[model samples]
Target: MKKTSDLEEQLKEITQQRNLLLKALDVLEEGIHVVDSSGRTIIYTKGCEKIEQSKSDYILGKHISEAYELDDETSVQLRVLKSGIAVKNHHTSYITSQGKRADIITNTYPIFENGKIIAAVSVNRDITKLGELTEKIIELQKNLYSGEQKRRKHANGTIFEFDDIIGESDSIKQTIKIAKKFARSLSPVIIQGETGTGKELFAQSIHNYSSRANGPFVAVNCAAIPESLLEGILFGTSKGAFTGAEDKSGLFEEATEGTLFLDEINSMSMLLQTKMLRVLQNKTVRRVGGNKEIPVNPRIISATNVDPMESIAKNQLRNDLYYRLAVATLVIPPLRNRLDDIPILARYFIEKNSKIMGKNIKYISDEVFEIFNKYNWPGNVRELEHVIEHAINMADSTDTKLSVQHLPPHLREKFTHKHHFYKDYKVNNLQQTLLDIEKDIITQELINNDYNITKTAKSLGISRQHLQYRLKKLNIKKQK
Candidate 1:
């Protein structure tokens, strides 16, 4: 009786442990699939069901290749079972029994008992979303390159030039001067500026100003692309590089004899930075999973929204790559720093947008300009242009001026709340201050009314004769 009772207890403990292990496997995010020596599925996890869009009951006890609609030669689990070796980090794609395509990065290990391979256990991570996104990017890249090549035969790829830049500020002028000089050289140039400060504008201008102006100008934003695919995009890819990789020319090869603008270069990974540095130094590129070296001579122009030195300190950017790319550097001053240019930029945008929107906006009001000057433009020139565009949209077709009421709601609310009644009032002797304030009010009213004395007097609640007398006393000149 005692021996029988001990045997029952051992059986119960084994059952509990087996159940716990099964629970743990089902809860994992990655699919755990186990197959026997004969390639029959023994264990199929819930994760597998979710990823493959099939039920475990339908897969378990069936042949691994048949369940996943894969062949013995292509199946990682079957390959591991046949070779008795572990395949680590293999990128593969297969169609499920349900006929849905699945992309996975898998690690298949041979399970052994008594030194003989008895089964294979594979851990799989679904990368279908990432794979689809990569495919979309590749398609877009193909379209872009083909379009650019076609356009190159007709005209240059760049649309902007130094003359297109609308800034009279000393800071911008100085930056542009240095950039024009950099354009004459074949040395790599680095542009540093805050976000929305038109780093790409300067890059394109430099490219158009250079000897390579007639060649293809390719621009890619490093920060906008996925790190996993960036290397393949920049260095090209080989036919067998990954599951679906093909023999494709990268940005460097496409930009050969032209200029390749890498915007936000600091966003690139350190590993990619090292590889890029090697390519830059050698003036050639080796495709991913390819052994052949292709020579490229594109004028490399890299930009960073952040300070490269700070990026280096944080280990986000490689110091060596920075030095190589920054042979000639141009720093664009932010909009806040170039406040003197606001009036001109605002006017320029207003005129440009007016023609586009078919509105007759002739000027921005004094109050609107005051708000613009006081509010720091964090998005720099882009934000200013957008603000002007938004204002024009709000203005009536007959409206000759954009006013505070026409400003974007958020900007209007922000600066309007901070505006004090006395903020613009010059404090001095009571009589002089009052006289000055009155003169300013009458002058603004006259301008707002198109210098019509009758409308100004009616708007100010004064007689026309008294308004005329005040205008003369203040020596205010009205244009005919």
Candidate 2:
């Protein structure tokens, strides 16, 4: 009786341990299945039922080939059972016995007893959502590329007109007059100016006012494109020219019967400049891999931030190309030279931004204007506009005007430093001291008035010619 009781106790303990192991397997998130050496299912978890969309009873005790309808090559467990080798992270798509499809990444390993294969166990994770996500990403990429291609195709469209340009200074007015005259002519035009001086604004205005207004207006930044690709971009390429090359129209062809505005023309490579000169002379283009010449009639309007003559001297721009592009030339004066226009431009920007930002700003404080007058605007009109926008955003909601407190931190610090420098200065030489003070005053007034030479001279109680002489004597080159 004692021996039988001991045997019964041992059997009960084994059953309890087996149940505990099975319970642990059932709690796993990944589907776990075990197959005997014959490839028949010996264990199946609830996770397997969820993954395969079938009950455990339908899988347990059934052959893997019968339960999952998998062949030797497709069934990971069967393959592991036959080879006694583990299949790590094998991916496959399968349909369950109940006709449910799933994409899964599975790991199947062979169980060993005394160095012989006893069974195979598999852990599976469904990756259907991951596959769907990959397809969505590919679709988004195609759409993005398509949109960019469309933008390039319609690149000739003008984004601004003559009325869009702001400023009433004589220098600006004269530039506009010249640009208007150039607009009526088909001769290629070259616009030269410093950075941030609204060169593109003038180019766009000229295009919009010209007879080509009805046609496309394509603009290209020569410096922005890689030298290796600029040639093909400007003249296009033919299919079979190289790997993945496609037959496409270049900017010149796209802007046919319209205007082709080449910005930063000085930055173009010499080889590209040679090709451009040829195109200008012949009024035709040949694709990169094509020998057939295609007639192109785009009115070229080129611009450079630096002096074209200087560019020619430095060999950065081809002399022949310069002469061709400079049939008419317009030089845009910099903001420091046009200080008298600052208030006008500032007020315009304030009102514009007020409407855009939904603010009730009605005025700009004199303190703000004082700071504006003292600061040298190296970035020109664009910088001024941005400053005003930033101030508006920083202004108090209840305040009806922008003040110095709302100015950029850099500008405030600069003003403070300059004030201290002037306040602590000790006059050692009377003439030199007076001259320094005069220069400082003139510079401030010039900035305050938006660099309008006429207004600045008048404000300083001197003639415009006198102001020009002082500017030269002071070694102050006009901003540009």
**Candidate 1 lDDT, 1-480, residue by residue in tens:** 999999999999999998899899999999999999999999889989889999988998999766765667768788888899899877767778898888788899998999999999999999889878776865564345454445643255666789888888899899899999999999999999998899877988898898999988888888767776678889999886654567999999999999999988999989889999999999999999899999999999999988899999999999999999999888999998899999999889988899889999998878788889888888999999999999899877778988776788888678654223333665768898888877777766675555667767987899999988998898899755
lDDT of each: 0.85, 0.81
lDDT of 2 by residue, 309-329 (tens): 899999998998899999999
Predicted structure with the largest lDDT when compared to the true one: 1
Q: How far is 472's C-alpha from truth in model 1 (Å)?
A: 23
Worst 10 residues of 2 by lDDT: 137-146
Weakest lDDT window of 10 consecutive positions for candidate 1 = 415-424
- Model 1 residue 210 CA deviation (Å) reads 1.2
lDDT score, residue 417, model 1? 45
Model 2 whole-model lDDT (C-alpha atoms): 0.81
Clashing pairs in 1: none
Model 2 RMSD vs true structure: 17.1
Which regions of candidate 1 fall more than 4 Å away from where they truly are?
A: 1-43, 55-58, 61-100, 105-125, 134-156, 355-358, 396-398, 422-480
